[model samples]
Target: MSCSIKRTSSTSYRSGGGVCGGGSGRNSSVSCRQYASSVIGGGSYGGGACSIGYGGGMSAGSLAGGFGGGLGGGFGGGLGGGFGGGFAGGFGAGGDILLSGNEKVTMQNLNDRLAAYLDKVRRLEEENAQLEHHIREWYRKQAPSVSKDYTSYYQTIEQLQNQIISATVDNNRLLLDIDNSKMTADDFRMKYENELVIRQTVEADISGLRNLLDDLTRTRSSLESELESLKDELIALKRNHEEEMRQLQSQTGGDVSVEVNAAPGEDLTKTLNDLRNEYEQIIEKNRREVEQWYEVKIEEVNRQVTSSSQDIQTSSHQLTELRREMQNLEIELQAQLSTKNSLENSLAETESRYGCLLQQIQGQINSINSEEEWLASIRCEMESQNQEYKMLLGIKTRLEQEIAQYRALLQ
Candidate 1:
């Protein structure tokens, strides 16, 4: 039979067990205490006290005289020769207080256990040190990566910023140019209005001149009719005077009667001739003067009308050309505005594209970081399992060595 016990106390551990065998009946008891430290990889298990006890018992019997003859020793005594007399039994008890004593044996056992534990602890410490070293190296490798890769992006953003600034400047310049054009156009329009007003005034003056020419033409026609009537009356008066002279001669018959008058009535025929000639000269002079004045006025009015017509035509042509030029300028400005808008839209699209690219890069960096953390965790777990395996193997080795030592002592 075998029995065992285990317990914990204080900051130390003790554990031992013994196997007993005997040729006769026997029993033994043992007690042991130990302090130990356990570790797995880079971690520590901190505990202190333990107890272990074991005992065994066995039965044994001796032979009778008939069976003892084969042993070459004759029955030496009467009890020795009997079947039930050669019986023997033994009882043993031993106790080991593993860490409880200042005794050498206890000290040696504790020292051995402590040495084993210390060796295991040293191995674990070395592993932890290695782990820490590796972590430090990894951090060194990854530290620079913590800063985002923004150099290329920064360049692109800077370029975009520059482009935006340039575009703004250009836009302002374009606006200024447009304002200038507009002002110039307004000035031209004002000039056109002033020219139009001048043209209307000139046309009004021409109309007044034409009315005066018409009035002069009518007065000349009235003077010609009055002159014709005066000529007819003078002719009628001469014919009447000739008729009266013929009548007086006929009444006097063929008789020659001489009558003296006061200066022969002043020569009636000569007087009539003089009156007609003088009237004709006056009419001719008046007609020539009126014709010359009418011609001069008509010529002056015609010259003015020709000049006014030419000026109006020139002004109209100038206005048409200005309008065409203004239209062309407006069209060109519209095209420029359209081009600017397109450029702005392209800039916006470029910004959006770059933003998306940056987002993707950031996400990739995050994934890489997470993967690194996962790899570190896996490495730690592997190291822990390896340490546990090493510890279990060490325990197995110690148990086997102890078994071999006991067997040798028994021999």
Candidate 2:
């Protein structure tokens, strides 16, 4: 069987020599070096049994060495160094410097492929940052650095929450104080009303006492007038009795008359004197008692009026104090309510701010995760391609060995 290995460089290797000779008189095929290095040709093959396809037209294959200086850097260098020198010492000793037709195209293609691979390797360099860092730190750097920092936001929120709690506590306390103050004021109002009622009653009593005093004065005056009239009547009766006694004396002066009785009924003048003294004593006693009673009533009324006045004053003072206290409590309650409203608003704003920040952080985390997954997939694909290239290189090496064995058989 005869087999041929054809390459892009217009070079060919066969599994059989031209005739029965492994080293035939076939001129070498010439090529040029264009890329960093150009090596075209596999190891030579010897003749085989049954050469059915006719002898491999043994042409002189002049494979050109290239300008590659490093190890495994040229085209097909992954196989071996100088694969063409398979027991034939390679091609013509010193070939032309220009590139042959097919070899030029092949070198150009190889160089382009190599350059593309290198570019892909350079482009595949890890551009994404490491994934092991803190998420907050990464966000701080990648996102707007001037944005409000969420790291300290936690502490600020806690402080605001604490302030809200304190304000609530204070607001509750103020409400309680307001309620208590209202109750106290209500109680004071009730007491003021009761005191007012008592004052009114006392005033009515005083008015009644004044009326009684006036009536007592009128009665005393009438009593005095009646006593004066009685005295005048007694005086007139005495004068008439004295005049009758005088006339009797004059009439008895002409003749001496004597009369005798067991009892003179009573001495008229003496009885008159006794009656006058009793009436005068009774008038005096009545006048003294009425005047004393009137004076006592006036004193009692005065004392009560003074007591009511003091009570009214006390009630007024207490009422005024309660009113002032209520005003103060109302003011305090208003202040506390305002403070509570402000704190509530601040709390709401803080909550909204932090909520937005949290959402942004979550979104960033998701994006980072996706990017890492993409990088992982790319790495996996690169590894797969590398493995495939290694496998192909192995296959090419095996094919070259088979050709060399064929050449050995021909020799």
Candidate 3:
């Protein structure tokens, strides 16, 4: 019988040993094969046996050092002795002569080592199950909660923005209206000032006309006093002329006397009578002319005064109406200004309230994002643990198969 073993620094192991051929005796053949691939820290081992061969392989770290050499030396010595006996004997011999006491002892030791490895594998499996249960519990405890919906908050923000836009437009429009009203009030004020100037001018003219009328009245009174004095002088002159005529008639009562020649005696009484009549007509004509002139002047003054008074009254009425209208406009403008101020305050308050709400919503969103990130990290950790568990399970399965093959070989 001959056996061979191969090993590499990379932790790969391959073995083919215990090949034997015999004739005439009960022929027994054992073949064992092992393959392993390993990395620096961890690796996998696989082995199989046919007939009566025992094979084991291990790789990487403590597993390679602890079990690889032991199993190799034990099986090599034990199988080499057992196969050597089979090769020397004839095929017709019974199988009871195949092993010596040392071979039995080596086999017993291998069986004890296999049982210990199996127990270790069972304990490892239990630990893996516990690890899996812990992973499940962690997942249950650290899972993220469902996120809250913010669509309604977004809609409310949109509505508030629209309202703010509308309020701004209304505020601008109100400002324009106030400007227009101010311009209108200024125009009315200008008109009132112009009317006041005209009224003052009319009043001055009325005062001047009143002074002229007083002067005309005083002139008429002086003319009447002069006319009365002229009439009394005319009556006294007529009485004196009649007394002279009576004296002349008494003196010429008896003395009839003579022939008077000298241009047929001039008529002195006739001349006197003619002179009185001429003086009376002249006084009457002068009085009638003075009266007509005074009456005409009085009528003209009265007409002017009446026209001026009527104009003043009309101007006063118009000024009063303008004042009332201006007052109404001022009242309306004040009301509109008050409304504008209230709306501005309301808009400002709305903006402040919504701004705070937006800030709170943003904070909530950030918190949710942070939680999602944490959950993602946890999921990655769980996946890594699951992969490691699977690797350990594969190692356990391979170890069990090797143990089953060792038992078969022992039997």
Candidate 4:
């Protein structure tokens, strides 16, 4: 006889009984067999099977079974093996008692054992549930809390970046200003050099004018000496004419008469006076001309010399001012250069410090990312473990139900 039971879900049970010849041909034997199957969570479990044989008033039995389903198949197989081994040992020990012809006692013993197994399954299920609870608690406790706020760090970085940018701009501007100052200084230097050359030329011209003035002064002195000598010669000639006229008068005063056929000689005194007057007039006129020429030349030379002196003085003053101004510009430029150097140094130091800070921040960010990844992996592992636990729990439930059914059948 065979009987089969089917559930509305994917579970089934089958039991069969038959009479057969024993290994000893003179004896007859009875056999009973049961098979159960179940499905849970899209996986099927091949439930435990029990078989018994009776022959020549001696009973022998064997229990062999396995659970077949899991998330990946192996976990249920291992549990099934352990449970099957335990059931096999129990059945092997009870097999000898069946020969005493107490079927009810054997059935009672099997039912009690099944109850024990049920209790064990209950305890295991409870433990599994507790473990799941603990796992959830662990996840709750160990999971990372709200991530640390990096808004402040971001703001600080932004401010630092802005500062660096502004500093860079200012540094560039300062460098440009320094360059302009250098160019200006070079231009001023060139102008100063040109002005110096012009001053030298003016000084050289002044020297030449001074030489020419000296020559004119010497010529004026020579001309004055010549005029004085001419006057002395005129005075000497007048004295000689007077002496000759006196001798003539003395000769005439001695009462000597001379009969001469020539016209009366021209008057010596009149002729000599006329000659002196004409010579005096010419000398006076020449002296006035010479004096006027000397005056004109002296005035021209003096004016030129004075103008040249003024120009020299003005050029010297301008050169002095330019030198002073150049000195000031040089001083200012040096100060600006020094300022630029200091700013550059400060900028370099700031950049280095900020660079190190950024590196540290990046390292911190990397570490945080690594930690997050690790946490995610842990979470995934936990989830997998929880799923496995759930599968095992389902197996345990099905196993408990099978055990209950086996108990009902035995009773």
What TM value does model 3 have?
0.53
- What is the Cα root-mean-square deviation between model 2 and the actual structure? 15.9
Question: What are the RMSD figures for all models against the true structure?
Answer: 17.9, 15.9, 14.4, 13.2
Q: Pick the candidate with the highest lDDT.
A: 4
Q: lDDT, candidate 3, residue 148?
A: 66
Each candidate structure's TM-score, on Cα atoms with residue i matched to residue i, is 0.48, 0.41, 0.53, 0.60
Candidates' lDDT values, in order?
A: 0.51, 0.48, 0.58, 0.61
Q: Which has the higher TM-score value, candidate number 1 or candidate number 2?
A: 1
Error of 4 at 390 (Å): 4.2
Writing each residue's lDDT as its tens digit, candidate 1 over 1-411 gives 122333222232122221112121111122223223332222222221221121111121222343322211111100000111121112112222122223334335534653554465457557766876877687678655565566785786678677767767877777777777778778877887887787788778768866866776676677667667766776776677677767865776787878887474577557767876887787678768877877787787778778877876787787678778768877876877787678668767866886687678668768868876887786787577566546545543443444344333223
lDDT of 1 at 323: 75
Runs with alpha carbons beyond 4 Å of true place in candidate 4: 1-145, 235-261, 390-411
Give each model's clash number.
13, 12, 6, 0
Order of all candidates by TM-score, from best down to worst? 4, 3, 1, 2
**In candidate 4, which residue pairs clash?**
none
Candidate 2 stretches greater than 4 Å from native: 1-270, 373-411
C-alpha positional error of residue 409 in candidate 2 after TM-score superposition, expressed in Å: 12
Consecutive 10-residue window with the lowest summed lDDT within model 2: 72-81
